[model samples]
Target: MAVGATPKIRLSLSEWGQMFIAFGALAWPMIKALFGNAPWRMFGSVEARRDYWRNVALVMIRTGGHWFSIRHLQFMMPNDRSACRLWGWMNWTSVISEQVDMTHGAGEDSAAKTERNPSIHWVGQSPQPVSTTGNNSQRSNVKVVLYIHGGGFVLPLSNGCITMMRTLLRETNDPSYGSPVYLALAEYTIAPYAEYPTQIRQCISILHRLSSRYGVDPSNLVLVGDSCGGSLCLSLLSQLLHPSPKLPQLPYTKGSSEPFAGVLLMSPWTSLATSAPSYTSNAGSDTLPPNVIRRFRDTYLPKSPDLSPTSTSGAYKRVDPMQVASLSGRYYDAVPDPPIKGLTDGAGATRHMDSFDAGNNKNDEWWKEIGSVAKRIMITTGEYECFRDDIVTFSNDLKHANDTSHGKASEIELLRDESFHAVLVSDFAFGIPPCTLAAKLSGWFLSVLRNPVV
Candidate 1:
């Protein structure tokens, strides 16, 4: 490595494969078995759902397997009365969705036909009639939620998030919350396939679409997100507040609802442009097998693809949310250039500048980008069990972010002294107060959703 010069670290295909093989050897059990949770059974009984994964996790752990993802970690939780208390509200699809993506909107998708729990109705009320497959007359003046879920820029409808979604809905009306919860959860698209602005676009699109169908009121739209989903919602709001002229406009149409009533986040990564003190401190505590937990800074850069798969020059610039450079880079991306520049399109084209080709070929460029997309995400790990830092940094950042930009009006909450990365959600499994303390942060979102402020 030379001063003021970038180092070139190139490897042959066999070397790359071997490197991934070695990494995969460590990652596979954790990912396939330990990193993820068991899939939902075909309408399994509550008891079956409750015991199935826990039992498997316990067996695996006792047999020398260790917890990596939240799903596998549940086995180590108590599952006693305390765990029941903590997990009480957290055992539903709604709570799981909220925990994973941090939105109720995913649960409320018109594409999804939910169980007719008429107990839950459209609570939004807007000035203009919202488009809906159903009649608006049946709607009530109840509140609704705009939720976002977490997945590493991929993995739509991911496993084990439904429980948290259910918990969120329960939190809306729990004795802890002082009311019942009613929300519409939404999901968004991820990078590589969707590109930079698409993530935000999907979120706004959902809101616009829901406006007509759900009759969501802007002031009453309680926004919530967890993990990347939390970051997504906040970034979406930030983008909404500050739109780029180059971007298309999405206003209050018959499909989209008004802006959020309030916002709620759990272990949210709100400040995309900077790294909190916790990124390195709690890196070890994160349960993600590789760089799954934290965001990578480079990923946010322009990522239009080439047809060839071997073009290293055209690697999609994925980013780590824990790094300040990542978010700061986004601002740079938004910089407006002088109109005199003979540019056909806006947002300075990073598209089609292939280190390889996008046209027909062996085309490992696109394939390599796809392969690396999963690899390049934030690999959160350290020698210490320091998962608390990820959430703490986020919570603090949210408060400070609001304070600096909008005078600190944001009210984000955090669970005290909890290792949020791997074991956070398991508080409901076998925790002391168990999931209660763990779910408190989640409950915050639910409370705000059910009874949004102003």
Candidate 2:
């Protein structure tokens, strides 16, 4: 070596490799301990844990971990992928049966039937008709709330969610909506197999299929989705754009066109691309690390940097549900080279961020494209929720979407505080703070769903 040459602190290849392994081992447990520790546990009781695991499993799959991987199987991993799909399915089955009885009295036969049926029965392959007092002859102003349960993409509905759903169903008739209510809580398909477009497609499918069955006036429809469900709400509205894109495909709703009168999002996961301010701001407050969001991408997308080499990828980007409506105009782009407007030219554009220029596009172009869908797009979440900033940013975008469209169709409401992840459910069973947070969440969402705009 030259005498004057500066020496570098070089380690042997083996030493470098050892360092990485050590960090992975040390770091993995450090993170897990944060979740496993009692004070940090989001699900304090069986009711809450069931909801918590469902989201955890779904997020795990997205990060490229297989269902049976050491990480995912701690819960009923593969017994049912739908079971694995987060939220909205069955977190709280009994809550509805109780609500049904409290709302609609049970005769001997009715009570017996309800006893046998329970709310879980409401979720079966062949759902029985929901008992209501309204006569079929003349329908009044019926309020319809499209409730989306928040599970990472796994676990069925929870008691908190079921109670929440029932309360909304009842509120519509409580002189609040001034009409009898019919609720369609989306039992959307979850990932690993269903992934991206599949969940959103099924959400729209249910809306179209049920609108006729329930006599739902398209104009009176309201959409509500929490956590992963919130993602679904964004996906559904994105499809309803005006001058609708018959081209520029998005897996969430590539070939559908169904719209809602309004939408409500709770603790939603919005953009999957950028690092928003909340990532750091709400970092410690998150019961689940933000990395879980990235982990969920592995379930369907191809092996990207966010996922491991052994991880898989699909033909889709997991699809961010609440990207500002303005950025959604890939379908509105006039450029032929890039089928998706605003994205870079060619196949590479579908999954990568290249020529992303939503600013150049006309204001309200996406809102106009979404046309008159989801008149009231409101969100309710706690400040401590890691997803807070994302929702805030998206809220700003929705305001922008409304301004550009020059339409009064869009609006939002916030119920924010230091409550942690899934505060609606978690706080009830755990946390020093009284658990009325979820109840308030229920009330907040119902108010918006009822559209008492002031």
Candidate 3:
């Protein structure tokens, strides 16, 4: 081989198949638009306005494409060992507390400041001095934001995630509430590299590290995630509330049984097993198409043997067989009946505990156990998002579980604003929903700290 020669690239059939999926995802929206022009372009509906601004904000972050676009193609297209080495830099990042440096915002100014000052001052895996550019002082409040960034479980945290965290920490300063926030960005292995529950276990590791090192109280820690990250957060919550024998045990659980302070989910991808009404009704309005959604689903939890015409099961079969199995049952099999009661939705509607006959009491006990964890759960979804219905279902299911267990329904506050899927995670130039949503999140975090339930 010559010193300055260009290397020839070859992709396996599987890689080619991935590329085909990527092309399909890219083309689906364009094809839909061609058939009957997007509603946002036609009628200027709230949904259209949201879709427009969010994409604009995304573009402002960087050209080429969104982080997911790059990740999607990279995962699908096969590369040789040499090519893998060349692209390995983009695939993953280290998760060690001392090594991970998350600068709050974007732009050359933040970059320059980070370069000059010790942005992340690590002291033996403990909470280091978190200093902003202007202040140069330490934050007094002992709050940590454990962020699980979203990109269909394939992409790493984008500029959007970094910027959102920076903005939230900067803007969310209330004189009344003296909570200082430090970010602990959770980095997990993406799929095609690792499968479903592996991401869950990685999250547990991050949680443990944050607790053991930073001395962050499990209750003071806020589990915040968007898209699939949101899904992971909820999944983790379910596991915590109701432990399963099949699943591995989580270490460093604060040496106590109390749950985290609060859980905030932004446009969580809850149900990948099937499509919701929003998948079709809001398909054109959403940035993510149905096929693209399924592609990610296929990568993480491929079609089960029963579902597929082919009898063989793929390596990634997390959701395949489990689709027919009751995950709730599995998790709650060993958990005792929950002690908490009076769970309800924001609407003040509650289910009657005795609505079902005594025969179903065993099932009700599991729901109760699941409901007892998490003092606060804030579910925010873009009204026109493809995930809207599933989120609604998730909320309702939790509410029902609370009702069945406690004999009264408790409120699960849901914010269904006019926006597209992943509005908060995406960078936006001018959008009412994203900004308002951020403010709401700040307020919620403050409330959680000031008036912690547990």
Candidate 4:
């Protein structure tokens, strides 16, 4: 079937049956756990170490993730429109649909492909333009975080994502933080519903609207994402720094060249490839299965077009999903040195420049341009997650890039916790108490805003 095609009613009924069977299979184990008959040791080394309730939750999550198909999961979750409407009915939130004009900078050829307007969910009152004249400038005190949610690029905006954003909004508004924060959660077309460049375009449109229409200063805007959302964050940064050939150039607002306040990435899926050692070592610990990851990767990436070698000219060349998806790989010529031991906390780490020659590095120019999009970047990953190794490698490369290019120390910070993937978001979703990592994330945001990089 073509991507984004709706399933028939009969197919939906079959999927519902499959979902029930999948859940029914877990009933025995769940009952055993409730009766204290199932020991934690049987769950695996990593899961065994977690609290009993947490272990049970992990089992259920992993089961759902593995047994369910993308379509089935999509059917179970609320669509973006419905999610936005639900949020609007709550206090202190609103939703608005913004029409995207692809023809603005993209030529007519690109614009003729699709017509869709995306929605933005606000956690507080929608921001309005403030005067910058005189000493009454309110722009400096106002911070806006534009969040891109993750669902393996298939599922719609999740309640967990919304909960995380609300928590962040509350934390940033504390007197200690002293910033009136505004949160905007972007809604984009996911995979099977759409492919590459479509989601990117919608995000770029939302960003442009925020800056141009709402008069948000780029310096006050923060970009945040988790899981696949983190990948989207990196993709957006990549597009801004190095324009993708497949998409139109982003039109910048006034002072758009100024670096953003910060970027917060929670367990970002840096690469689709599962060859990293963590994939094997943490297989039993993480919630995602290798096959499931591959399924998502295949569904999101466009199949290569059939063309003869000679006919593969510039006009026919396609954007390589592998290259675009792997931000760390694209930034460094070689695989970065393995992360140093005992560097889990958010602290400055020693740079490994011995293997690299500054003058000879092909991406030095790109590295130097890091400060153009984001002044400060903070990444959080769990020690037991499948993407841990790649996240560490990416953090090291990013830190080195920023320090070498801008002569700044600690431009990048990484926090590694002994938990599962997207642990912070999960904490909010499951009503688990805040962990050390969550506290640090809030602190990082406040620190960045309070001490702006001039």
Residue 38, model 2: lDDT of 53
lDDT of 3 at 189: 53
In the range 120-209, model 2's lDDT, one tens digit per residue, is: 113212222333355432222455666776655533454455445555455445665444555554554344433334454455555544
Q: Candidate 2: global Cα-lDDT?
A: 0.44
Candidate No. with top lDDT: 4
What are the lDDT scores of the predictions, listed in order? Answer: 0.37, 0.44, 0.52, 0.63
Q: Going through the candidates in order, what is the number of backbone clashes in each?
A: 94, 41, 8, 1
Runs in model 4 deviating more than 4 A are 1-11, 33-50, 87-112, 129-141, 175-179, 253-256, 306-365, 406-410
Q: What is the per-residue lDDT of model 3 for residues 1-454, given as tens digits with 9 covering 90 to 100?
A: 2110112234566546555554555464444443334435434765556655555543332221222233434443332222222332343422223322222212213222222111121111235444445523332337777777777765554545645655665544444555456666665656545554456656655555554445565556777889988878876665565443434344323226455677888887766633367877876567665545554554554233433424433322222211111222232222221111221111101111222222332323444654345667788898877788878877767666776764323336889888778877664324324567888877777677665653
What is every candidate's alpha-carbon RMSD to the true fold?
Answer: 16.3, 16.2, 13.4, 9.1
What's the CA error at residue 221 for candidate 4, in Å?
A: 0.3
**lDDT per residue, candidate 1, 77-157, as tens digits?**
331122223433443322221111112233233322221110111222123344445434223344656556554443333
lDDT (tens digit, per residue) of candidate 4 on 83-169: 666766753456654444432344424542663555576765667756545533444335788898887787788666787777765
Give the Cα error of residue 178 in candidate 4, in Å.
7.7
Minimum summed lDDT over a 10-residue window in model 2 is located at 97-106
- So what's the TM-score on candidate 4? 0.76
**C-alpha lDDT of residue 453 in model 2:** 56
Clashing pairs in 4: 4-192
